[model samples]
Target: MVAGDGQGKNIHDLPDEIILDVFSFFSFNELIDILQNVCVRWKRLAHDPVLWCDKEYIVRGRAQNGRSCCGVTCSECAHCRCEKTDREVLRTAGMMPQLWTLTMMRGTRARILRKICRNCPNLTTLQLHGCQKMNYSLLKYIFEKCPKIEKLIIANNLLADRQYTELVSCLEHLQSLEVFENRRGAGPVLLRFLADTCSKLREINLSCDYHPLEDVEYFVKAKRDTLTSATVRWTMAGKRCVVPVLKEAASSLKKLQLRLFDVALEEEAATFADLGELHNLRELHCNQLCPHRPRLISLAFQPGCLPLLQKLDLPHATDLPDDAVVTISRGCPSLRHLSLTFATSLTDGALAEIHRLKHLQILDLSGCSGLGGSAVAHVAQLPALRTLLLQYIDDLTDLQPSLRHVLDLKQLRCLDILYSGHIRAVPFEEFSVRLVNFRELHVTYEEEDEVFYKNVLLRCRVKCLGSG
Candidate 1:
């Protein structure tokens, strides 16, 4: 009987596992729009719980009233039809049993959020951006349902005191929390609550006030052995509130970033000295948030301070003199990345000292007007130097000699000379031929230099920036 009517092969004839494997390559949107409608077997595969795990849905566009998700009118606007559509979408997608992350944008409805928490029990990370409707009840519902959540990010959302308190109480297992643009000062209470409840908490980024600074000090003291990274953005008046925290966490803290709105005076030199105690610190960023305030130049580090430090960023510190640069070069031998942007006092002599950091890969001397082509010769000496930024170094008129010197370093990759006014011309073809390993080259933008820059771009990646 000829083996009873043999038929041609079809995609459905493949094993279920193979079909699922193929489905894995398609994104959630693609699966919904194309693959699901292909056939019954594909539809069934699309609905499989494994495909939804780690899926991310990003909804863009502002609310109908032209106000963002965190706007005051958000809760009162019943006419926001877009909210309903978003809620419907969330309700449909929230049914994924294995979904682990949820990012809610500005106009997301409260009921929709409740549906998500109720549906997606496996959610471990929740990011709320401009989510105005995030009240105490909604937050409590999420915490009660999604008990495994470990990371929560709230940006540009002004939740009430009660809401913040409830939110903290619920995040008992949260390992990381970031609250940005929080004007209401929920930081102190939140830090205290996290310190008390979330013993596993290792990372925190909070807006700093005097009260919050006290809370942070206490938190660091209490959890000195656990907390590893902390980033504080100062908003209120404070002098030495941060120093005590650093002192307490000196042995354990690995990364620290402080954005100070106020100037650090000579009197606070002792406070700055406290950083020397952080021997385990690998990354340290000290930024002066208030431009009107003179940069904290009085702050100096002794030799062997932060010996293990790999990354140091102190941009726009106008008073970073040669002595400070020398101290940094002496102290941080293991440093790989260093940024001293806008350091007006940093001269060629400082670069000579910095060249001693053999492990240094990235260096930014942007806006250091005192530096000339002589500084590049010193930079060329660094064995591991890969990326060099010399933007706004106005005195650097002749770069060809320095560029020629750097060409010897086989590992050199990125070179930036943007806004260097005095460099009248560049040997683009010569640079392209010599610097075989170059990945990016940045030059100052000029109408006349278009052809020169275009030629470089054709040979290698090039970016042009306007002279400041």
Candidate 2:
């Protein structure tokens, strides 16, 4: 299948620009670990500096056997973090001038970062994900070296209490800072400095217990329109207190995650605002928030409210009714990904309304006990759906009809029904030959079907999970 013109027949002869764009999507590890070994042209494309800069390019530091490479350009060559190879990788990365966003994987040596930080003159974004045993000195070194760094994401690492002047000094240019504390990294010192300076800050995600209620309010008020994304841990009382200030920049805020304190939230259900003012919000997530049942009906999502909203995840809304979901469908019509994982009160009527989300691609109704097999038929009509999770719903008893209904979803790649007790092995014997474009199927299976599935499911061209 080639173009009508014979001159452009080969798909392999794609333009260098198009190829570079594709290569840019590869993670840093994939670029070195996979693309560099594909072929000569691909290897060259993988090295393009333009593809590496100004993006969230992840630089993974893999474990080496504590020995330097023998200068052989083979596997474990410079990709692993040995003393000599670390320098080699850094030197190679130095060619990518004006590199902005970078993520260093955990276990990556801090010494390697120190070697390269001075070279990142234009670096604006840096994230360190679980580089073991991190301390104040190493962080200060990065802050002092990369003066233009505006965004810093530190997660899953041990950052103990220590004072550093570089953090205080360089935070003046800071725009976005996120620190998922492990030991004591995001303590009073960083919070105090952030409240004092960083006037240009647009996003702050310090999802740590150390985050005080006052700091959250201060950041929202000070940044106002400039603050676009906020992820913080708040108690039920703190959440109520911030709702008023949240309206100050409701139009500007795009993404918000309110992870409640691990306590019984029933105490605050009498006085909680149902965020209807965030009209321009693109994403909203509420973690472990199970409000009173009566309050779920009064969820203030009016029709066509969040027109620009694309994602809504309310995982612990225990008894969310059909009308509330219908309201979400009408209000968040533009939603592409929706999750009401434990909304047990929703019925088939809500799925009917959810079909209105024409652009919806991912839907997760994992523990909604009110749904049945007919619900599958309703969602099957969704043209753009790719992933559907309907786990732990024992009410989905009509397995045969559900399987047939899902065939209509041409784009469905992953279908999860992990704990659907009604599923039997007999119905799935023919499933291997019938399914189309099914990449993954999660179903609880018996011991007898294990060997049959181990061989036959591969022919179905899908990854079969839970077939122990």
Candidate 3:
């Protein structure tokens, strides 16, 4: 191969394996738009089955001008191209033999969905988003044809009573199911069906508004041993609905996320106590929609709860105080990722405790108004920290002390300090010189400081984004 003449050594003359490897990096749409029309060799490489193995075909109904067909101006716009329908897009995408994921966005028709279910036998993940026309027949067709399907995500769809029952009856083979923002509730019948038939289910996510507490209790009691991950959001029901579900799945559950709409301080405290029983839990996300409630510091600060927990996300936890941070640092030493966004009660004291999390990697302290430069100094102690988001921490004034410490962490990759107005005056040239391994640096500065930082970052050869 090395002996070939210079004329025969062009890119197109490369081996088929090399060409296919290059094609693997491009999205399906990009491949179809650019490489497919280049030449016969490129077209053949683009059509290789390996390129489509885990590809996701996004079928959305929108005019060429990027506006909905139903919009008032779509009919008169020069680039509307309303004639191209969802069926046409699906038909073209269904020609691929190895596609494993199909995401049907708004305006997908029932007949087109049925055709996809019939044609794409290898499809393993189907996500339907805002597909108002999705009905019982289309879902049943999917279950009948794609027997090996493993995950189903249904969001913002409307299902009638009969259609809902048909959908539940077809979930016997699925391993994961996620339902969110449905216009009509699936009701108790759907839960009963899942409990009785979907015994192999390992993950379930329900964020709908119409869930009944009784139905959830029944499902938890029936599927306790088999369920491994569960996420329930926006449920109006109180502790009665949440406690039973947690208690039943305590032994087998690994990941749990709860976002309750109506909850009292005492009720939430009680719920946190139940979580202590889930010793095997690895991820815990608790969000309260209600504001101005008492802090959950005391309940979550227990010493022996969730020994294996690795990720703790409590965004919008307005009541989280510094004591809670100390508790987490002492108890959840295994945590690798932590988020305390909008936790206004946290101060430099919390950051001192958080520095003890030796394995911590990704930390998001955005909107924590109480945090200052001292907190940033504490963050530099973590050896494993990679991505740090300090957006909206307006009190962060000086970056000199923090930058000195951060330069020592060789693993740091991304640093975002957007909207920290007081720190804009620091010489970012120092940062550009010290953070040799940074992949991305996001900052916001006044117009006067932009040119200085841009020139300094250019010299350091790093990607910089935002107002600067």
Candidate 4:
């Protein structure tokens, strides 16, 4: 008839953005396969910076439950898995100039990094979780090009002296920075630079434990009452630091944590008064080595202190008395996410008051052994709860008993029952069918019964790990 249009001119006829959008859905290997084809128009379109920048190739493998022989090693990876991804990455970096959002966890050399920054000038949101072979010049090259970066997460400790200094000095415009390594030697220089030049910075996590207040003096000296979020590793489990540093930093801090500071359970009780000044404070995570329940209860009920608090974590807290839970639920009307892990003192009476938190979304009572089905029954009444984690509760033997009542949580998406030694494998088909919308349902079972839940339960993404 009319020459049949000849297969619609292949993919080359489409606009650059449309072609890039279509390429976005394809996996890294598929994209490489498409590139290998000899089509001039397709080749030109494939070189578009948008396609390279918007793409993220995550090489993954099946992870086993228990320790297995094959293991999660790159050696056992499928054919050309690593090479294909690398080729595409190198090609994209060499071809495109506007590529952004690069995340490479495995085997990245400094040469590749330099090539990436040289081509992709607008790169942002870099996350290097466990990247080895990363040196100072690579990091310097990255920061020099992307001065307006918003988020920089360097999870591993693979930085040299020059790289660390270059990162702090050049990337002063960074709004979010997370460093997982213990960089105490470079602390003074980096801290001083951040304090002097990085006023726009908001969230920072330096050490896993809380830092001293004096360490972050730039927060007060530069931004003065404008700082929003901070986490300092004040002490280790065995090692303790003075409270003066933490107290000063807590003055304007909206989000504060004392992750490892365990000794100041009684001494820092008056710092409860300082918390009252943090009117804008929304998240608070406190873990004490020696949990004084009364002090926790007192700090929880501090007048006008936690009015704006939304997320509260007090794990291993044995200090909370019977009435403390009730008092907290009544006080913070906006309190939505709460975690009471390893709290041996909590009982059904404490859970009863939890129903009052109208906006509750997440509830974690991992090690509260005293909690029975009745406590879970009360929490099920919470209308807004989406995730529930109950671990090490020896009292909960039957899932059907509590599941029937908890099914009322229409919004509930995840239920994790990990290491509850008493939990037995039951037929979860009825619950799975009823809760058709549930996304994650993790339950623990004996080694032999693991297969029963793994295959039997329909619409249930089950994870049956070791219990005892």
Worst 10 residues of 4 by lDDT: 60-69
In model 2, the runs with Cα more than 4 Å from the true position are 1-46, 53-112, 116-125, 129-137, 147-150, 155-173, 183-196, 209-212, 236-240, 261-274, 381-383, 392-403, 410-414, 418-461
TM for every model, in the order presented, reads 0.75, 0.70, 0.82, 0.72
Give the CA lDDT, 0 to 100, for residue 345 in model 1. Answer: 72
Task: Provide the overall lDDT of each model, using Cα atoms, as 2-decimal numbers.
Answer: 0.68, 0.65, 0.68, 0.61
Q: Which residue pairs show collisions in model 3?
A: none
RMSD of each: 7.4, 7.4, 5.8, 6.4
Candidate 4 regions exceeding 4 Å error are 1-109, 127-139, 153-167, 183-189, 208-212, 235-254, 263-266, 287-294, 301-303, 316-324, 392-395, 398-404, 422-436, 446-468
Best by TM-score: 3
For candidate 4, the per-residue lDDT at 304 reads: 70
Error of 4 at 200 (Å): 2.3
lDDT of 1 by residue, 1-468 (tens): 122335766665779998788778765556656776777777777778787664654333454443322342433322111233664566455435566666665546677667767877777777776645666667778788889888777753442364565566566678877777745543344556557777788887765454545666777888888788888753333554475566787778898887864535443545556667788889988884233323223243566777899999988777766777888888889999999998877777887777679999999988977775567778778889899887876656544456456666567788888777655444456666676787788777667767766765465776666544
Clashes in predicted model 4? 12
| lDDT for each residue of candidate 3 in 207-293, tens digit (9 for 90 to 100) | 764656777777877878878888886343443446545678778889988776455544666655666677778998878433334
Q: Could you tell me the lDDT of residue 225 within candidate 3?
A: 84
The residue pairs in collision within model 2 are: 106-130
Instruction: Give the distance in Å from residue 318's predicted Cα in candidate 4 to where it truly belongs.
Output: 5.7
Error of 1 at 120 (Å): 5.5
| Error of model 4, residue 319, in angstroms | 5.4
lDDT of 1: 0.68
TM-score ranking from best candidate downward: 3, 1, 4, 2
